[model samples]
Target: MADNVIELHPTSRSDLLARLRDELPPAWRGPRIGPDIPGWTDPPGGHIHDLVLTGLPEPLLTELAWMAHWQQVIDGSPASVQPLNQFAIAYRRACDAGHELATSIQQIDWETGESLLNWYYTTRWKRFPPANTRFRLRAVFHVPRLALIAHCHQGHWWELDEWHPRCDPRIPIGPREPHGGRIIPAHITQPWLREAVKWHLGTQLEAGTLRWSTIGQARQLTRFDRWITVAFDDPCDVLSDPLAAPAQAAEFRRWAADPVNRAMRSCDRRHRAHRVHPRQVNDDLRAVAELFAFVAANTRKARAVLGASPWSAVTALHADAWRRQITPIRHQPMLNADHYVDDHALAQITAALPLLALPRGQHMLVTRGDGTTVTAEGFGDPQVMRMILLQILTGRRASEVRLCEFDCLTPVPASTDDSEGKSLTRFRYAQSKIDIAPDTILVDDEVVAIIEDQRRWVRDRFPTTTTNYLFTARKSNLTATKPYAAGSYTRLLNKFSDLLAIRDSKGRPVTLGHTHRFRHTKLTRLAELGLPIKVLQRYAGHATPSMSMHYVAQREEHAEQAFIATAKFKADGTRIRFSRDDHDAMHLFDRADRILPHGWCMLPPLQSCDKGNACLTCSLFATDATHRDVLQHQLDDTTALIDRTTTEFASRHRRPMPDDNVWLAQRRAEQQALTRLLDTLPTEPGQAIQGHGCPTAVTEPVPLLPDPTFPRRTRP
Candidate 1:
């Protein structure tokens, strides 16, 4: 034999045949019942040729091809002893698993092929370890059936009618029972009703019509199902029966409304109780109504058995059923800024994140607790820290932040060289909540670096995995290429928070226990900066203007802060009395600081200054009617300087100075700046700057050059 060519040794081939013969029963070896077939040949030299799969229908042929491909994969992997004997051994294993092997190959159908494939998986491949392992095999079986396509991934099979190409493979198959049997109450004991509920949810999940992130749907319906069973003293099937649905729904309303009865708490992740919040009542009722709709759309037998159409039961309830119930539905209150991370706190966290990327076992002070605090030894993996940073920096929800893909981060078309000052980077991500196309978010250089680091980490650790996710866990239980699932990411965040004992600004232990709160914090912070409602909508990926409005709500405190840039203070730390006029003037001083030559700045204090300080010609500059005199004076000065410089140059150079002449150009730039500034001065009466401001207040917030013990007060 050639040195490079791999051939099965005679001794190993004999041993492989012996092992194959031992795994199969005598019935497979005895061919007395039918005509001869390739797979049915004796185990001593039993072989399956590629020709055995010929002359079959397309579906069967493809299935057989997949089986053949899998066989080659397994045989080539490190687990197989004799590589040349792989096909025969797989054939024997298939027969051992009870796939009926007709003696004639021509008689085999797609059903027979499917049965053989399933049997082979159950008997051998599922439990087969790569004992001799050269390389791992990742064969995804796309088995097509009459109604839907069956997806076989990592040895498990799931029926998926529709699949998103960009979906995270880490997402586990939807439970045959919705929410892993948690949302459905156990008391509703009718088997078919339970099955009907499962069918609707599962079908929706498989069809991509329902989202796993929307946990409320299953919980609400499950609560309704339990309530109907208890209140009506009837089987679950009664809900499907149109005549019984109105009464069933009415009884549920009574049960849901009764103050004495315990409110049903959601069994999903949040576990929110139906008590107190009117929103829960509305959601639960709406959920039940939606369940009825699903039943109407899908289940014909259940519809027939229920006597009325599926929607009959849902429509029977009064349109104001939520208000009529014991608990009246009310508008859900918008979120406030309290949930957001304070600027100081965000700075502290950002500073700490870089240290997290250090090699493991490096020591650092994690938290300062009164009794016991976690030390540097308690930090989580660098990947988890990166995830937290992404959340803080981008204000993305946990799902968007965690499932980031490698190639999606890019520079905005208008942006160039991120290393340059003020350049921006943008990331495109698949929006998890809505079915809209990928959305773009602006991020800074730091966030862009984090993303790059994560991509390198994934590539280095899981080199063989085909996953394109930027951040991937090295050890995944599902497949070689599984990205971190939503649950896993959440758990990691919680674990990191608990171990480090990270705290909030109030000196209380602040856990990023609720990740969605980060999204709230981000949008609220942006809104606090007085970003346009439309801009905020795009930044937060909100579906509508109203949704964006919910996050941008202004509080009285925010208004107060905007007006009073700083409070009067004394060096002795004693209270200083100030007049209302003084307080009102301070507000005017704050507005005057950002007054430009074109438009007024309505932005809040916490936001970054987007203006590059070229205030002379920026379109965002604004000057009111009161500034017209000052602007005209500046323009006159500029014109005088231009003429003086031109005349001086003409005398000295003894020739016409070119347009590119440096001194002449400076004079022209000054002229243009003042000219543009003058044009924007308004003629109409409007609010104007009050109090004679010092140079510091009129320009940017430049630090005073000379150090002084106390801050110098600006002369008004």
Candidate 2:
């Protein structure tokens, strides 16, 4: 996170291939797959080389693997050095042929519509908007071959909206074709149509007419076209029915467009109290229509084109199954850098973390009180973020305090508990519930200004929650509640990433990692500081060391620290001598006992001294090897602790009333001072194992928040 960071891009095509070689087996050559990279067929049913060498050499693919590292890091961002879209088209042919990055034909499952969808969408979405994993994967991986079917449905629906004719079905909106067939009209402004197109085109694949039975099955493509063709060819009886009266259609459109009705339908949505998100709504509405049109176009093909198969039997769709087939991606990590980790790209992410100084969260981008998103790596409410970062910055936790709620976020006396009026600005919210998540608060001075300014911007646009997005209209068919799910943080992040022209150290675009890398870097820094893993475990609200470990990444540093501290003996059975100054600076004490310098040398089933915790027989006790092992183990333990604590905290934090004040008090003081107290701490000295003992620095008590198992306080 310091300024001494390096970028990870302009990668060597040759080097990447070499690197990839390590990823695969020795003597590996062809593409990973069921089908070799597919190329376009010659005609109606033409098939070309299953795997074409074409003009491209292996190096380009290697460069692309590197490029994708940057691309995915930036959420599928286009590279400034090269236009990926230009080259990405080449991958499409392979995706169309049902190829993927997996190793064997056994790794494939043609029967899984979703798997097909992943291959289908990743290849295609790689071509355009909302730079992200979805787009990149859709560009090359999660394409939803069922997408064509989903599209066929969306397109069909869109066509019908126009085809049905608002005025009269017989009256075409567009000019007639030379053969006198009804043609789509020009200049018709049905906003709904646009919404539908976005949905159909976007990665939200609605399998519409081409429903798949599962996520795996290799020989399933044979049945796909048949199912689509039969459904398309089936005579639509509704077309024969008299078209709705112009007045009746107009009334339906009006009802559909009503904001009140849309809001009503979203009654259970936790964020309904917030207001309608016009862009999200319009996007959804238009998508629905586009999906219908997409469906129609593909299915309208000839029955002869289908060729009889199990797919042909799918003419009748069960509406529920059809709907279920289309699911919005449910994110687990909220933000994932797995694509960039361990590769050169990670350096940039680490650098960007401190530079952005955003809260950390890899999952749901944290929301600030005003509905602005935090650019962090790990998820948090704004207040929790302020507290955690405060700890990171100051290296101290609050001694005592309480979290309180006002009608809305407002500044109050920091000493409200006393009459001192020595004020700390605290933001409050009612306890969050399943139906209504907590509103966030901003406490950091730097972040508070940004949050307020962003809020003002939002206010200028909406004025009131009832007014909705000033930039857009909350039209019919688009529900208001969807934003809470997709998250304002995500939407806003796209805009911010674009505005900042931020790039990871990798020379790829930088967008999605946001505040997440910050969380990891900060946690790693904490581990380096020798903050007891238990302290970090509580600070992070984790249940165990493993869970907390995700945020702490510098294994080498921890090992080095432990190595120098514990390993100190000579062949003469005497301890290494240290000057008084060295002893004081590094915390060394004289003892007539054996020691291990680093825990690294310990074999599995490591032995411990007979004492309560091992003092001797530790690899750290040995001066022969550097004490890197103990530091590594310490980090691993801390990581586990933080991960466990955060999960428990998130769950308990969301729960309603607590019958036990003891449980509530444990975290209250720490939460209140988290933001203000952290700034006073020192940056880690980055020490390696040296001659040592306990220092005066140890005298200051570190406030510890217990993990999920909040221990009871004992009498002094």
Candidate 3:
């Protein structure tokens, strides 16, 4: 192994100088010059000689000059040369003694990279932690030439511990921008297993199944990998052997379920027992299953790449057993009342929206953990308040609200005014989760105004930006290409809540960390307003009605109260008054069979309705003002049918059919029943017709047949 390891020698001064002179433009290689020099171009301005005179080692000097040149060209700013020179001096001495130093970043092997980085961090860049070292190394590796060489030679980016979005195109730039994209093979503790996992992840990336957003979830497989390393003397053997699967699977399940092996410990100060959340265990098992399944599916490819098809012998039974063992932790119910933001919290949050703004010459008082007060401009970007407002009004997902295009609003034509008096506008946003959902919805003037305000702010702030998004990221986004991060808005909202000390009705401090609650609140409010389910489905932008139904929480008591509040009437237009005892006995709201599309069944729950379409003419049938439109439509259709049938009969037999015909009689009876119901029921919903005398109990069951001569009195 020692013989195979490649040794790198530092570049000599003459060689390094020659390379730098050849690589850089002619204008850049001349005598030392400052920005004050006349006719000095920004990048090619003569500063290479000054860098050479810094007394730094040849390799470090050349790298720094190249970085300075690249920074001036890329970011229109020169690299900070003084601090890097001071650090490079120390680095040169360490290299001279053969201490913690690599000849070049490209030559640093993955196994020894961490120790070198730690040494640099602790001895030199102690002010910045390893996590934040990227900022410190910005001038060092941001150079395209160095980064490309490191990638091409070392088979990885210059940063061995993490991969940035620029490292791979598949890695998303937006989600974890500015910071590095994902932890790499160096993060794995076991060397033998690291390469295998790396290969597996690469395969998944090539297959287009793995996403950078979900990479954190995919990392859960490392726990299983670590367990395998401990369980088997030679973990590599288990990958190829068929019989090792069942035992491995069983042992992994036990290990993952154990509280001692839990990934995260309890942080509570009360010393609560650290229990492994079922979700964590399930995520681990799922990752393992996915890995094995992928290998099994692509056996030849897996063998060629990984040198072994891990879990190739895993059968359906083994998979089933693993799946069955997964702890069934039900997520918070979709219709959970607490999921929606109540009126108290919502009112407080809305009232505090103005405080989110950082007005010129004004400061917000912020109290730190130590009880000391300091003034801050405001929470975060003031645009977040408008984003929150949009969510509360539109019930859109956070992503949809945050990633809205600059031209998301289109003025609705005045001719299409269904909003009565208010102006309606069609608001458009990306429906990322559902591919088939409509991107545009009709919003009121208030929603339109909010979007318009955001548009104006964006235009004023980024006048020269070419990006089309309404909300652009404020940090590390020079070109304004990236969308406003969802996490940024969430943090801003939380800060706003804390600053204002917003509280709910119960006096507990309101934390709007989950902005989706605004969406839930909006949907729940719409549902409460008695909007038709299909219409609500469209408004929510759900692909299916069932998905929309999940947001509506109709409790049994509310349903019963609504049922009792609605005025009921029999087929002959006589009102059916229900006493308290009669309401209890009928169980009208509890029985599913009693509920109908256009009306309710007045018959007892024990009896089945034999009359199918005869509901309109049945004596026991009852309906209210809500079904008036349906009844009227039915009556008009029946009248049209009667006219068409009479004309057809006269044409076929050369004479009109007898008036006493059963079909004609039934049609006439239905028409009369519908007309009487529509006329008797008030047009306004929940309005009941006044009875002449004391209310009667609806205890007697009536026949299903129509009774034309029935008296116009309340049923008893």
Candidate 4:
């Protein structure tokens, strides 16, 4: 037994490495690894002292420039840290990543190609990691599982079109970079990916019991089958040919057309018992299948071209079939399932608030519908909080955010100042788990308020047990089922799309397909306001600009506005007075603005001036006088106010002065700048004029209404 085990595991080689390490002495270490500290190389003899404990996450990869250095192996007289057999396993895993990477990199220019190759070579190249480098990439990236498991894990998402699968390989999976030595041809991953798609489609079609012979009249499928065909093919059609290098597209097309992979058109149309279709629907499943088949086949071509992995060719072929030919067939109709919210768009909406993603175990304050706000258990809770945050930032009320759904919001952001005075603050969470599982819902300020208010009403009524989820599911005791998944504000976006009220330069209300979509709004605003990329990264809690981009798309106009409006302040509560301030994004208020409770009101601040007199120095300033006058004029003509034009119009401002002597004295200088406008304007412009009763300016509460859900402690 000992001999056999030794022969299998190579204990002698392990022993030899151990003996060599002991012989080398402590000072002669090659690399060090442990829980607290990452791996590092020893300057002495290049002996790698890797700390491989029972369990730990894979190390992070180094920058692209250092890929080669990451994969270097320590050269010993006759000893090495990883034995030959173990090395083979490691290489095998890396080969999978390489397979996927080959497809991703196939379109890169020579320079980018070289850089990526460097990234791989340094960390996993096996040449010899640099003297002090521990380049570890994601574990999943290293060992791509492009099959049923891959589809099950990540391959089968309905939004593959927008996700840009070919482009998305850049999105890193878990960490655990391969030793750069794994070199599989890229062609392998292509086919495997297709096969994985095939598995997903197969499973879903099997489970749904849908008929296939009923192809669309557009094709040959029946009405129901047509619906399924559209549902499945929509994504494929969108992804079939994206904006990429022509060569890549050509190569992709050729690979898809390869003889080894054949398109499946005629359907059996029979399930366990359900007879979906009596005869074959569309005898010809044209470009739809062609697209999938091509993508699947082409993906394989990249793998083969690049020598992606050691997976059998049959497996690769199967993968390609799955991605293109098979996966599209299943596409379980998202029956009774609410649509997936555009999370990135949600982040875009919350420009003023933080829209971030923290690692597992990170904590945040979350408020539930029952008004019970707590530092919830895990990311699940924070995700809930994110929904709330989205509502708050997008200017939705709690009730609105809670019930927000398709066609709820006005075309424009609701401000208290509008004549309706009451901006529509309403939204709803879409159904949860109707099809594939939906991400948790979120609550924004308005939604939080509604929940808090509802909680108070509930507490007054129930007075005993808690009712946390606003949209709670009710099931009979006899039908035991999965715990109810709560809906959140994050998904409320689609509900409020009508309320977005944004218009393009073309004067048309922009149509955002996804309902949960304020994230893009906020991000677009911030990006236009020229928030530093790094700051955007921090604000959005993105691991990198690349990752953040996956959520917030950049538009040229927004970029221009961001450049023109960016503002930075010093720690001393003073503006960083660079000449760039002219183009800097002007934060309307010196401090973050709070939504005042009594009245809806807020406008751009007075233009940058030396005591409000830089009017002459300013170039962008409209012919309007002191910005105060401009605002007052706009307010006076409030009924005719077309839109918020260049906020940089000339204006002098008075500070919002405090009531006390100390406060008055300190804020005296800027009092006219901030206070004059507030004192000058009435809460309701209509009432202010025509000798009607003057309405006090109603604004958001300061420090915000205490999250009614968060239990407040009494003073001792």
Candidate 5:
């Protein structure tokens, strides 16, 4: 008998047995042991108890009793006797082999528990330990006393294997399930580094500097820890005196830049180079710099635990210099032409949306590219289809669409000045990325209807749920408290694309993996409609106009090319031909203010227009074939107004009004100008009314006023 082992007295054993008999059900009370003992079972139920504690070792019996008591209390039901049977078999094997036995659950560390599981599986079951072994150990470690002993409180931080962010009031709820809220600390191999990283992360959380869903930051630090281990003989020594390890730091730069050193994924084998993306390297370096800066700021307190500060002697200048030493990687620009979904693909996807409405756990029959039929799981939830439709209609980010609150739509108040009399709705969404962006945007009736339909579905599906989200996750979420995960939605969308065989204009398979493409496509369409950049910025919910400009800039370039390619007509129906120099000097596409509803104002960049809405009649205005419909509409509207005014005046005065009536004359002049513009435009579609045969040519170039100093060129 070891000193750590507790010897239960006969009276104590009798009390335990009596309590077990009282608490356990009849099926778990019958005696059955030896070769008849079964392996691990789910819902662990049967007719007989495989093992009894009547004649077991006192230490093993005491451990089993403690587990049984806690299990019953936690479950609020009669506890299973499976753990006793499993451990008893291991104990008997240890006795047969003359191996040391654990006195209690507290004495069983991870290695000792693993060996016990291995013996139980290999000898009795004749197989290797299954995945459930860790789960069983997790159950054992969750015992009240064991958990208290393992976890430590370190001033606003808990040092534990896992952290549940949802349980903490300081962390905001993210668009993920409660289980996804866990932040595991086991990935950081170095204990000291792990502690420091935990402290840094805790400080960020406390100060509200970290986004609740940002797990990549922690993963980036893990890469740094791995590099430190590989790059130095004693990582702790190097961390303690970072400035002194110049050579090691240089080596790290080389190691991080090498593609061979990068982690390999299953798909990477298809590529010949297997090169790590520069963006990943940049993220790793940036994370390391941030961690070092944080450690340097709190030298005294951090040093107490880490033995010495990681980068106390390093200054901001030193960190900046180190960052500059790495090769700069330019950000890959996202071009709208390359990323936006074309009309062909968008139409196909919209038509196939109904196919995604399969019920949960049911598979749909799909034809593969090889013509073989196979059953595959669809999105299952109709809300996912509605969510996709909302993304296309509203052009919102996937997070904003997926994490919408149950009551996100509200009717816009009718305004006295609204002449259109169209019903409007305002949609509110979470602006997760930009803090300064407004959450509400004006949406159309169609968008409102989609949202309302989703709301109805949520109500019918989860009648008892109290969650605020419109879209709820189905897995491991009995209460429907978790919003749909972004990753899961993306995976399902990819599957949908494959099942429907969605193809692009080029006949290649179109992947809807990047949901942001919908946003880009919407912004690009708005830009093509000649919406101002400032308005596009607000519509996009961007913090700055620059991001909106990125999408508009590409569309503007195409517009400019179209403008230059077609023939341009002045107010007097004179066709103007642009020499290369004339086109550069006019900067026709550069100024947003000069972009007219029906044409371009060919005014120089330096000039300003004082007459508003008079571009249609200005000599500087240039109209092409594309504006033929708009020019004809303006002419028709002007003629109708003039005739109506004349008739009303004649009726009031009992005679017809004269032609020179001041307002009437101006209206006549505008009407005449629009008629002439419409006549100059090509009647045939895709026809260029250039220098060939239609109107008198002003072939030389339009002259501009000279200036002593050059004016600033406006961006397109």
Candidate 6:
């Protein structure tokens, strides 16, 4: 009975190394597990370590412990950290339950294994184990009814659960999810080629050269693999026959263009289903070509004949043919103003946010069309609502808002001009997709308060744990504490919309898609208000102004309106005459007469003049009382020349700027001359025009508008 009740204990480093070395194959076994095998080295000699190795089989447990490192050297890799941790949890539980190590390894079920993995993740570690480092397991869970599992390992926790059967050899189930979710090679008819491709992809995944996110590459390569299997009766003949490469590439082109093959079809996320798109066709062709290139370069037989890979040439030829044959697919632009939420719909969504965010027990009423109201409890947890609010206020992507940490919100220091002691609060968070560093946005006090409340909530809920995330879910019976899944807000937003009976201006039910529209709505509104392109670029986290423009609608109209408003043009259908006193008008110059009807010069005080008398095109040219008479006479002469040139060109039917017509060039030049003269000339007799409209010979330059759209910086 005492022997059956195995008191688990940590093994010494020397003893553990001896056991692991013994488990290694005959070729690998030595005085020490050293460099010949990839990861094994001198085990860190420590008396106080985390993992307790008692009641485990000598070979299997030893192998599992060194699995992460040895994966690189082995042909058939052992479990990665995620699945290894999961298997360890299950194996430990059986051993603790008085089952022998051998029986425990075989008895663990998927359901039980998965449950323990979630518990380890949410309750003990709160995140997955770190990669590329050796793991030292900590305390095992041995509480009654709850199975024993390894909780902490390495510096982080061993908690990320995976369904990879190959990770645990003791499991009887066949491997369903392959390494990195790659399509199984068994599906391909060519046995040897199938194995080769599988090994290549698996090695890439283990080496960290390829990621699970990029598993789509494996799917793409599989298309080519299937093609190879059919094209050559013997697929191995690809290495022997050099001609197979070009023949296969040509066949692929035909296959791609054939509508019958359905190679051109792909899933369109916009429609939420599969649809035909040419870009996807192009991607598929490129994927196959790249796979061929990779195989040719790496494979010994193919490389011996082909000096270098010929797939580049093959891909180029196919690309040209594809361009000629396929009608160009008109892609939906990344930024479409049509997708922008209407103001009325946005307003309703904004108004309902506060009510929806109200914590449980707080009552709110939704007014219906017939004037009857529905009493409703809070829409969701306060943190969920706070996340939505963050998206709206900061115009951040929904994912960015959801993944924010506890200290993401910080108060901006008071500005130099902020004598009233009021300062905007800054929201800072990570953008995982783009690898963008902490993006910071300054928001008003209302947003600041919401952030504070959310931070307090997360802190209160996770008082003891190091989970500083602003939003978190405790582990339930089956699920892990998911970092808010992408698009988590979409369903809740729709629910809130339904609850409020919200409708757009057209009387259509308003529907939100993935909360991205909030970003578009905010940016579109800013664009509509005529924010500068540079400012929009910064706000959108875009690399270029062109990328930012996708969010803006009616830019030309907005620009024209902004021009009229900011220039403060006179009403009554007449251009306002400038006086020397009106220096504010002179500062609006965006490089001279290309913009303003009356040209302006916004150059610094000490700048030297380059253009002597060419005031029309020169940005620095300013109108004055002294130049009025001279400008007026020039305008009269230029108008006469332009009229004569137009009459001559129309009567003769010559080109507008024919070789024989010096008058046309003269007329264009004089046309600018006339504008220059008119701008300097006063509309009213009493007013004197300086550059553009400098009244009273320019006294002092008015301060330019300090754009509020810019993220205002303040001292820390």
Model 4, residue 29: distance off in Å is: 71
Predicted structure with the largest TM-score when compared to the true one: 3
Best-fitting candidate, measured by lDDT?
A: 5
lDDT of each: 0.50, 0.33, 0.60, 0.32, 0.62, 0.50
- C-alpha-based local distance difference test score of model 1: 0.50
Please rank every candidate by lDDT, starting with the best: 5, 3, 6, 1, 2, 4
The digit string of per-residue lDDT tens for model 5 on 1-716 reads: 37775553334534644654555444334343322323213232232444455545654565455445434433222333555566666767777788877555556666776778788788778997777755665455444324222321223444554565433333444443232445656688888778878877767866768765665667777766778787678776655444654555566667776765554355654653666677777776666667767776777767654575444555554455446555677765645466677666787778667667877677767654334566766566787898889888888988888887888887778873246776788899867777778888888778988888888887877675566788877553445656777778988888776676766555666677788888888888787665787888999998788788665435433443345444443344444444433443245655666666666665567877775665654545555566678878888888999889899999999999998789887787777667655565544333323221112222112212232243334435
TM-scores, all candidates, are: 0.52, 0.25, 0.63, 0.26, 0.62, 0.49
**Which candidate, 2 or 5, would have the higher TM-score against the true structure?**
5
lDDT by residue for model 2 (413-455), tens: 4545334533434433222111132333323444344335434
The C-alpha stretches of model 3 lying farther than 4 A from their native spots are 1-103, 108-135, 138-161, 170-185, 229-247, 258-260, 264-277, 308-321, 327-334, 359-377, 499-503, 506-509, 554-567, 571-716
Name the candidate, 1 or 4, with the larger lDDT value: 1
Return the lDDT, model 3, position 32: 30
Instruction: Return the lDDT, model 4, position 289.
Output: 42
User: Using TM-score as the measure, what is the rank order of every candidate, best first?
Assistant: 3, 5, 1, 6, 4, 2
Model 3 pairs in collision: none
Candidate 1's C-alpha runs over 4 A off are: 1-189, 202-209, 228-233, 236-247, 250-276, 294-328, 332-335, 351-363, 369-376, 413-420, 436-438, 464-466, 477-480, 507-509, 553-558, 565-716
Query: What would the per-residue lDDT of candidate 3 be over residues 155-206, giving only the tens digit for each residue?
Result: 4232234455543444333332232334556556665456545666765655
Please give the clash total of every predicted structure, in order.
9, 144, 0, 153, 0, 12
Candidate 4 root-mean-square deviation in Å: 26.6
TM-score, prediction 3: 0.63
